[model samples]
Target chain A: MMRPTNTWFAEKLGDHGIYTQYMEDHHPAHMPCLEIRLLDWQQAAEIALRLEMRLVAVWATEGGCHDQPDSMFAYMGLAHPEHRHVLLRTQLGRERREIASISRHYIAACRMERHMQDMLGITVSDIPDGRRWIKHEHWPEDALPLRSEFAATTRMAQAEGSYPYVSSNSEAVCQIAVGPVHAGIIEPGHFRFLTVGEMILNMEERLGYVHKGIEKAMCGKTAAAGIRLAARISGDASVGHSWAFAHACEYAAGIRPPRRASYLRGILCERERMANHIGDIGAICNDAAFSFMHAQMQRLREDMARMHKQLFGHRLLMDTLIPGGVSIDLDQRGCRLLSEQTRMLAAEVEHLRTIYADHPSIQQRVIGSGIVSVNEARDIGLLGYVGRASGNYADERIEEAYPPYNELEVHVPQGRHGDVATRVWARFEEIADSARMIIRLLEQLPEGAVSNAWQAPEAGTSGFSAVESWRGEIACWLRFGDHGLIDRFFVRDPSVINWLGLELAVRDVPVPDFPLNNKSFNCSYSGNDL
Target chain B: MLKLLKQIIMTGDKSEPLPDSDAIELLGEQLHAHIRKHFAGSLAIRAVDAGSCNGCELEIHATGNCYYDLERFGCHFVASPRHADMLLVTGPVTRNMATAVKMTFAAMPQPAFVVAVGDCASGCGVFEPDHYAIAGAVNDIIPVHASIRGCPPEPADIIRGILQVIARRAA
Candidate 1:
């Protein structure tokens, strides 16, 4: 029997220089959860594996008495089906601050540990692979990114030279470097593809080409400013990012949004999901050279965007969701109009899907184009439609059942094939499901204030909140300072887990299919870059 | 040939429809009003990413989504500055992207509106000071007309920013 609270084995492990306790604070939105404090990093790793906690995020915070500047805090999130969350906190000092690498146990920790290493200058002992992740070798080795004392205005006097990419020795393996600047108008990322002829033998992606110093800029910002930062983490997922940040702040502050506001939030989130799905379906078809489906999907996507504009007065619904509640509301006439549009759109989608299913060319191109087995998906901990397509149905909407999602009986559409076609089908299914959910939510739309006045929490309390964005689970953790401002905030986007699947899915597929495979996963590069 | 002709007739003529002369005059007036209100008469704009850290790029990409219909306004993101009316960039302008940023700006045609979308772009947002690669804010590289500040600004803010630039040019 798996009870929610009994999921973690941390209770049985007991006091090995680590303080394990559940934090139930009402002030911040994410307060009512479990927190474990470890005196050292090795202890954090032991408990993480022993307790079977997934490494959600690893972020460092500069600590010490206001005068002494060398203390650091490394935070990690661990979870099980039984307990909603288990937070692991470790404290480190300048003299003896090395932690054992947990990347061996949890593969997800690889990038996070590297990020912490680059930012905080923390040493991870006995790591199998220790190549620089975010930090290029061109920069001074002594320069730590997340240090509080690091000067902001100082510019590097000399232009650093190019980074040396690692070479491969496998037979017929030649490296193909693509993008920091691509042919198309897109964000920058460096992809080193190791290929023999057309087939990709292995692929190594070097990102951070767009690394904006987001974490550093976050310091000294007010809660409102932080929400703006959160929303910007990934522009397409603004509602999700803002909701997650606000959810954390609200948890720390112990504020609940008005019921109507929560319902409206659901509506906005569904719209975001629908818009992305429609665009992606089109893009995927375009990648497959199916021009007809591509054009139709684009038209459908445009229609949805128009509906969004008519309702929210913004096409992407940016900044519509605030900390206490939503910034916009739907009137009776607007609600009626939205309901009608949704019905029409739903019918159009069904008709288009029929065309897609009956088209042999589309089916042949997509059916098993980029097959990621269920086992591989589970092992990699894939998220959203990509994960759902491979039978890993972990939707935060259904699992956590927060706010409006709790009101509507949400059914997550899942598939077993785990291929491009299956992923597309799953996405379509979710789109329809979201439309239905939106209709239900609108019909029973609550009437109340859309927002509540918010105040920062008093010092030394913390909280965590996880929401299912269109992509997957987005978890936010927050700690309040004495002055009622946010002391520490950490967010983990679904892309962090989903990107790993890309490396696996692209293996052995010809370079031509890379676009198709990438589109099927459609993980946000910006979301993960954080 | 006969079957094709019949099919075309049934589909109500496949060729481009010719405008009626009387209605054309009225339609032209409406078109002018719409263009004046929306397009801002061939204004040039440049995009600068102060230090996005790329979340904004996804939403920026969303601007091209059929639903958002950014092209309907005659606004398009151009690759080269020699032909570009605007420079749309994302991220915090890392040490690496700085030179590219400057080069991009230099390449763009003058009288351009520079729009900074995302928090990192506007104020370096979260990726500031301590980031190893960042040079500074987008303002450090180029003057900005409007700043859509989100971690990544929603596609709506982006569209709004474009409209604001056009509106200012028209004014």
Candidate 2:
């Protein structure tokens, strides 16, 4: 990256006569990799957006500012190329703990803002949807789980009544409600479909059924222990979340892991991305009644999962990431194994790609079904494969220029159709791309110590980090308490934003096609709910 | 089509060794003698996720795929609880899902069995006792016939647990 600069803040905000304070590399070495700045509280979103800066994540923490009655800190992470984030600090306080919502300006701020309000009891005024986002009736009225003062053993109130889902009143439109429990072996999410016969008019989803108080439970736990919680936030994307958490700790403690460790982490991340993508491509085909691809894809996934367990010590690669670097290291045999497997898998995937293109039955099922246009995808700020499929290059590896990535010539696969066919094609292309990257990583395995004994970060300091997961961007924002334990831990699983894509893609498709659409996006309920 | 046929011929015997005949025999005889006499040689299971990490859910799906082939064990996952002979629930019972868990349990016919799979459903796993969202453990919401404990139990472990429930009833 370029040497850190502070002039951009003044260049953008100077016209408003808004006071600006900037810090270079203010966060830890691997943190949300942003320079720090203080913006006028009211214009946080406006100032960042005016500079054409991309919004990464928005999070709030209960920390110092004791004199400002009922005050809590709200941080907005923004990205401006070659680097990743610029944390804009704003306070929500004065006894009310309320702030003007930025949801009207940035659509991504919608769910995250509602999450803050629901979990922290921070009232966000002018929020587009003021209704309970993360809170069901089970949360006791007085229990704001994320606050510093809340007890760990606070009892949940009895959940009561049904959710108030907004519905459109129209002539001859019927409603079909499905799940918190589904027919398939999957996590819980409720989908309400408004249909005129088989064609979908509108679809709305109600999630957070699996909110296990991940943020609340991690509080007071040491950073080492907190990594387990992060890994479990979304089991499928365990490596992504854990690395993000580890990077945040590394950042906060000012520890830069050795180059070898960074390369190993990159391998872990790409392996995760490939496994999910391969399985999803098969699953999307299965949803369209092409069962062979499903079986073959899953078969390939099972092999990958087996390899992960053999080398990394867990089926899902859960807990493979520790604070300073990876907990597991690969030897010569492991490197040879990865090399051979990548060769075999690439050939198999190439064979399937040809079959997918030539087989009319499969092509018919995938090509035109479940389309989410590019404009709609960008408006919500999609990331990773989903964003790439919609012609958006928001991959953090490229945009953030994180170590190892900057040194290597990384090729990001992109597509433009934004339909089931393109999504599947996008995932297939990603798998091939990842195979090439993994092969490269294995051949270039740097020689050094795999990890270091992690030093605890100072108390009262926090860090922000984002890693591109199989689905999209996984952001973790955290702080340490006085005893080197987690003070405030917040995770924004990419599924939290990508869930909206399901709503858009399912519209205009027949009722049966909804499953195909859902599978193509493959938003995880556990990830979003957490 | 020729490639598919050749591959099938080349990759022979994909199935695993069946469990001990004693367990299967006991399972068969037990159903023949006691609970639900008319139902013989087969079982219908409905999987419920009170609140879980979805790690367990993935393993459970693997059990049904060709490698593990759970259906060969005379068990099949059904869509609705009303038609199910047993319930396989995962995750710590979140408050939002507790009522639905109860409703699913109540809907099952008499002599229904509940198999609480994964450490989360059995003992609340890494999650603690009192958190606002989770109620902790599947047993807290419904009576459990068996508990399978793992961060995410292996598919083999899950299949064995389902059989153990029948063996227990037989004894």
For model 2, which pairs clash? A28-A251, A29-A251, A32-A464
Q: How well is each residue in A305-376 modelled by candidate 2, as lDDT tens digits?
A: 778878988878898888888888999999999879877888887877776677788788778887878887
lDDT of 1 by residue, A148-264 (tens): 667544454553656656578777788898755653445666778988899988877777655655565555566777887787777678888889888888776768889999999
Q: Give Cα distance to truth, residue B97, candidate 1, Å.
A: 1.9
Model 2 error, position B37 (Å): 7.6
- Candidate 2 wrongly placed segments (more than 4 Å): A1-10, A23-26, A29-39, A65-70, A159-162, B1-12, B18-38
Candidate lDDT (C-alpha), each? 0.69, 0.78
List the lowest-lDDT window of 10 residues for candidate 1 chain A: A26-35
Instruction: Give residue B96's lDDT in candidate 1 (0 to 100).
Output: 55
Model number with the top TM-score = 2
Name the lDDT value of residue A64 in candidate 1: 27
